[model samples]
Target: MGGRVLGYGTYHVLTHLTSTELYSHCELVRNKLVPLK
Candidate 1:
């Protein structure tokens, strides 16, 4: 997929990062993540 699509997917994934248990996974992408801006 393209960068834009990948970014969207990452944003979607971030949305599910509310459960502290998943913070680690969120951190992995948080730095390189680009929201739907």
Candidate 2:
């Protein structure tokens, strides 16, 4: 039970981190590709 809970939490954390990283990467690319105001 504990192991399952830990695994679930870890999976969610990794997913969140990956999503955050992806968003940041997209933002960076957009900033570089798009002109500033």
Candidate 3:
């Protein structure tokens, strides 16, 4: 039970990190593809 909980926590943290990284990457690409004022 503890192991499962730990696994879930780790997965959630990693997912959060990945989501932020992906969003940053998308922003960079969008800046290159689209002009922003």
Which is the leading candidate under lDDT?
2
Relative to the true structure, how large is the alpha-carbon lDDT of every model? 0.75, 0.97, 0.96
Question: Which residue runs of candidate 1 sit more than 4 Å off their true CA positions?
Answer: 19-37
Which residue pairs does candidate 2 place in steric collision?
Answer: none
List residue ranges in candidate 3 displaced over 4 A.
none
Task: Write down the TM-score for model 1.
Answer: 0.41
lDDT per residue (tens digit) for residues 3-22 in model 1: 99999999887777655547
Tens digit per residue, CA lDDT, model 2, 1-37: 9999999999999999999999999999999888864
Worst 10 residues of 3 by lDDT: 28-37
Candidate 1, residue 23: lDDT = 79
* Worst-scoring 10-residue span by lDDT in model 1: 28-37
User: Candidate 2, which segments miss by more than 4 Å at Cα?
Assistant: none
Q: Which model is ahead, 2 or 3, in terms of lDDT?
A: 2
- Taking the tens digit of each residue's C-alpha lDDT, what string does model 3 give over 10-30? 999999999999999999999
